[model samples]
Every structure is written in C-alpha cells, then in structure tokens.
Target: TQASYETTSVYGHGHPLYYNNVINCLRGEAEPETDGREGLKSLELLIAMYLSARDGRRVSLPLEY
Candidate 1:
C-alpha cells in the first residue's frame, strides 16, 4: 500500500511558489517569509552529514568551531 503526499499549494509542490515569491521580493512587492539563517543552519547540517559519513561516527549540530 501507499499514500499521497501532503501540500498546501495547487501546483502540487513549493518550488514554483518559492521562485515566484523570490521574484516578488526582488520587485519590492513582498517581504521574505524566511531568511538566510535557516539556510545557514541547513548548510551546517549538510556539512555534518558529510563529516559523519566520511569519519563513520555520530555528528552534532552547531558543530564545534
């Protein structure tokens, strides 16, 4: 058995909506709903994944620097 995915957009996914929002922001029509802080956190997590995979060990967030 299987199940359908969940979403709020009529277009099935968020990419197009995200792009449109970016364009609107660039045109000074809308404010960002989110910011680079989250993106930086995500990048940190990705770096942790790479480190753990390379070293074969558990990794922690806000990785020691």
Candidate 2:
C-alpha cells in the first residue's frame, strides 16, 4: 500500500501549492514565496552536470553563473 502521508503531501498539497505559486508568480499577481536563490542553485547544478558530462571531468559551478 502507498504511504498515506506521502501521497497526501505530494498530491493533495505539495503539487497544487507549488503549481499555484508558479502560476501566480508568472502572472505577476503575487511575490514568490520560495527563495529565488534556490532556483539559481538548481540552474547552476544543471549547468555543472552538462559541463562535467561534456568535458569528462568534475566541474565546480560558480555562484554567479
């Protein structure tokens, strides 16, 4: 059986809330409730992953990227 708490957390709350937040932010109806730095960090991680795969070496991402 699926864990009740996990299912509720994701389907009932997490997904809808995050979706609404993104929609609202895109429409300029509300300020983002999440930290903008986290999005930047995710982008940095993606770039690092791509660079590492392309160059065949470990890559350290810069904070400004």
Candidate 3:
C-alpha cells in the first residue's frame, strides 16, 4: 500500500513488527501476539471493509464467517 510512514516507528503501517513477532515466536524467543480467535476478529473486520467499499454500504462487526 505504501502509505506515509516513519522508519523510526516501531509500529509501522507495513507491519515489520508483526512479521518480526511471528519470526521470534517461531524461534521461541517470544510468545504469539494473538491466538486464532483474535486473528479471526481482525480478518473479519478487514473483509467487512472490502465488502462495504464494494457494495457502498456499512458492514456490521463480527461477520458470520
């Protein structure tokens, strides 16, 4: 997406921190930031955003999927 960002920020829009966390978790250096349920919530919200944009309507939270 290449949004405006600051390289010094630990939490950038490109999600370097997220990938780092995943790698660290895989190497047993850190715990997973979120479990499946939390991940599901985020996925649902992202899908809802796309649906709302595509259909030109508001999408509700906690999608059925």
Candidate 4:
C-alpha cells in the first residue's frame, strides 16, 4: 500500500495544499480549511450510483429522503 500512500501524500494528486491545511490544523496553527461539503457531495454521488444500480433505475443527485 506504499503506492497508495504515496498517491495520497503531499506530492501526489495535487493534494499538497489540502494536506498542508490538515497538518496545520493538527498542529493548532490554523483551523481546518475544508468544510466537508465536497466530501458530502462525493458520498452523495456514490450512494446515488449504488441505489440506481441496485434498483435498476436512474438515481438523482441530492437524493430526497
């Protein structure tokens, strides 16, 4: 899993800024810069895709509950 770690590290996928932001937050030098909206969107999309595949229908984004 070294490759996976490297791919997610400060030098890969252009995630350095986000990584540094997290480090700074951990060090109490700054607050977390991300509000997690992007992560929520990604999770929503994944769930929609899973639902669509499971139910054999087109699933919509921002799924209504």
Candidate 5:
C-alpha cells in the first residue's frame, strides 16, 4: 500500500511523491512528514519482538498497558 517515490529527483528533497507528506498536504496539516520516525518505530518493534523471543516473556508496552 506504499506510495511510489521513484519519479521525484533527489534534488526535490524527495517530496511530493512521498505518501505521508501528500496525505498531510491534502489534510492541510502542513507539518513535516514521518519518514525517519516511521523507520524508528519499525526498528523499535523489531527490537521488542527480538527481546520477547529471547527472554521467553511477553513484552508489553512500557508506558501504556
């Protein structure tokens, strides 16, 4: 379900074709996109899954139940 960014040149700051930014633009949010933050969240989920498997324990969210 990912949007395509292949047409945007690097000098374009990789804008326009990027999915989140487009959605935000349509919504008039005008805030920055979630490019790096999305990757960070994916990494966090991977780490959580790894820790759960290694420790043989259920890994729950630390802040919220």
Candidate 6:
C-alpha cells in the first residue's frame, strides 16, 4: 500500500511535494496511533463508504448508512 501510494503520488499526480503534504496531513505515512486501532477504524470507514455507494444511501460518521 505504501509503495502504491508512493508510485501514485509520483506518477499519477506528478507532484511529490503536494502528495506528501496530503499524506502527512492524513497521517498515512505516520506510525499507527495505537497499533492496529487506527487501521481498524480506517477499514471500517472504507467499508461504510463502499456500502453506502452500493446501496445508494448516505452514510454519516461515526458511520450511519
């Protein structure tokens, strides 16, 4: 995932500084806040987005669809 992020930041966007800035803002490249906790939250958020998209419903956070 990190490698893909790196590649996309460079090739897809063609702007490493801007991409890195966004990455840093989003905490993607930083160490996890509490082991797998932050990761689990991200996965849940992603799944909620996918579900909302598939069902054509609005999903709100803390994630209500």
Task: Show the lowest summed lDDT stretch of 10 residues, model 1.
Answer: 6-15
- In terms of lDDT, model 3 sits at 0.85
TM-score of each: 0.64, 0.51, 0.69, 0.52, 0.40, 0.42
Model 1 misplacement above 4 A: 1-15
**TM match of model 6 to true structure:** 0.42
Point to the candidate with the largest TM-score.
3
lDDT of 2 by residue, 1-65 (tens): 75555454535757688789999999999888777788778778988898889999988767344
Candidate of highest lDDT: 1
Q: Using TM-score as the measure, what is the rank order of every candidate, best first? A: 3, 1, 4, 2, 6, 5
Q: Where's the lowest-lDDT run of ten residues in candidate 2?
A: 2-11
Which candidate, 1 or 5, would have the higher TM-score against the true structure? 1
Pairs of residues clashing in candidate 2: none
- 4-28 per-residue lDDT for model 3 (tens digits): 6566677555588789899999999
**What are the RMSDs of all candidates, in order?**
5.3, 5.6, 5.7, 6.4, 8.7, 10.1
Candidate lDDT scores, in order, read 0.88, 0.79, 0.85, 0.81, 0.68, 0.65
Give stretches of model 2 more than 4 Å off: 2-17, 25-31, 63-65
Encode model 5's per-residue lDDT on 1-65: one tens digit a residue: 99765654664654454666768777998665656777677667878898889999987754132
Off by over 4 Å in 6: 1-34, 63-65
lDDT of 6: 0.65
Give the RMSD in angstroms, all C-alphas superposed, for model 2: 5.6
* 1 or 3, greater by TM-score: 3
lDDT by residue (1-65, candidate 6, tens digit) is 34444453334654565556567758766542344676578778998899899999987767543
